[model samples]
Target: MNVRPTLEEIRRAPKVLLHDHLDGGVRPGTVADLARESGYPDLPTTDADNLREWFEAAADSGSLERYLETFSHTVGVMQSVEALTRVAYECAEDLANDGIVYAEVRYAPEQHLRDGLSLEQVVEAVLDGFERGGREFGIRVGTLVTAMRHQARSMEIAELAVRYRDAGVVGFDIAGAEAGYPPTRHLDAFEYLQRENAHFTIHAGEGFGLPSIWQAIQWCGADRLGHGVRIIDDIKVDGDRARLGRLADYVRDKRIPLEMCPTSNVQTGAAKSIAEHPIGLLRRLSFRVTVNTDNRLMSGTSLSEEFAKLVEVFGYGWDDLQWFTVNAMKSAFAPFTDRLELINGVIKPGFAQLKWSGTRPLA
Candidate 1:
């Protein structure tokens, strides 16, 4: 077994990613190609490198609307079945190259229907791409069908998720603007999923406050909290210690998973800085904290960059990385058998290599 290791070694360990947007991870060059194919102009930059910087700058402006605009160009090109398949395939390939062993890439099928493709067709194409990529690269991939919060078709989307449960679709999710569109607004969808015994996650407490998180868990019955970063609002800290309020206590006592994306949180103004992120505090508190890349292209980050950022800012070691890796495995949408296999066969062996080296396992 691989024993004590350096930080870079730990950071390179095989990872399980529970949060990443399919449209958000498109490479700038891929985006340019998609835009060109669709004859869609208005990209902030034409060159791949410059376009990457442009997306990052626009997202860093702290304007949610501007940050979201980047996806318009991506989704524009992904309207066709061929485009969706290619992007989804490349997403898995890219993650595998980054040392991600298993990843669940989420996307709103409704967004891709602009080209008149049915929701079933959209799901099929993405799942096909994921399967193809996984077989070709030996990377495990899953899909979370996301229903837009601002849209009224959540029930329809929820049904679609259940319909494809046996396929590559692993779970259902509700994402989009979280302000006025509280999880309660999608009560029908949530209730339906609950009745069908389907699992789901909700994007809450990112740009909003405690109420959003509360409704997501207590009202909407979310199995996990996406960007639950704002759950910090309910926490009070003293020096290096912290106290949790009633809601936070429930979340912790229940061992609910929080998908916290440091770089994306900073870009969206959810967290002031990496050092100030609630993830560090939550991790110290023994919360089931898992790191994620909420939006790779927009935030100009990868799972590797995210781990590096945490290591640099928090001085996290191999143990911390292992803890996060296990947390993600425990909270994955995959089946119990698959989850156990990943933890035992993949995560454990990967961590063994890192822990064997004394240097920081993440570089």
Candidate 2:
């Protein structure tokens, strides 16, 4: 039998994160410091501990407005170039310390225009931070430039992504509420990216249903689905077997990656709880699923903690974790050669060592 790995042991394994938000993972202490320095006095409490508790509590509040208010404060403090660069640097450092071998962090450039920084300035600042942090921390960092789906600036953002494609900007994305603003609303942007041969993912099927995901893939040509929890709705399961609908079949057959965020899903009522999450069924059904920390600060989770929760709920061992890591690495926006190098070089070796260590005492 495969021994279930402990959280600490899981933390030591090499992981690949494909979906993380740059602003969503800001450190509370850093948020507090930035707020103080920027004189952005809208924080509920400048006390880091209290601010942390507030964010945690607010996510669980089940109010959309309150949940969004959290980002407003984080974005409020992150107006200047220095603030953006520092947050990106610390984001890379924190992920590296948590044993992430590779990650692609994303943020919207339009949101940071309040402080007179040009869109190019915002992208440059973030890229500079990731470069410095990756060098010092021994992790590879790539960036995804995100455009809010509700806004009409996606064409500009898509152009921005292609503009900086060679300079650590690996991909593009569209994010925001999925209710009134559909992914197809930004079809021109997606089509533009497709024409440029640029990779992009769309926020879909989290707060909305099948049509959102359908359009994101079929219409917008999304390379991946962000928070694609509702894809579960298309599958009907009997005790031992599940039937995939046309859309679900297409998603699986094409190997489209679903970036699943468990705790965040529960917080937003997408999933009832971690145990009841669709990931278990999706993993069993062999869908291309990749685990992610959608918002580390808001979800109160890391990539390791996300895997540990899967272990506790589904009884996953090192092999299961390795499968998820490999899936994420394969689904990454980086080149095939680079992805293969990490899979064969860092990830496989790290998992092999951990599997051995995790079972040796029993032997």
lDDT (CA) per prediction: 0.87, 0.91
The digit string of per-residue lDDT tens for model 2 on 1-363 reads 367888888888999999999888999999999999999988999899888888888877654445656799889999998999999999999999899999999999999999899999999999999999999999999999999987899999999999999999999998888889999888888888989999999889988899999999998889999989999999999989899999999999999999998888888888899999999999998999999998899878899999999988998888889999999999999999999999999999999988876543322
Can you tell me which runs of candidate 1 are displaced by over 4 Å?
1-11, 358-363
lDDT string for model 1 (272-326, tens) is 9999999988998888899999889989888877887887788776677878989
Can you give the TM-score per candidate against the true fold?
0.95, 0.98
Candidate 2, which segments miss by more than 4 Å at Cα? 63-65, 360-363
Candidate 1 differs from the real structure by a C-alpha RMSD in angstroms, to one decimal, of 2.1
**Candidate 2: minimum summed lDDT over ten consecutive residues — where?**
354-363
- lDDT assessment of candidate 2: 0.91
Number of the predicted model whose TM-score against the real structure is largest? 2
Mind sharing the TM-score for model 1? 0.95
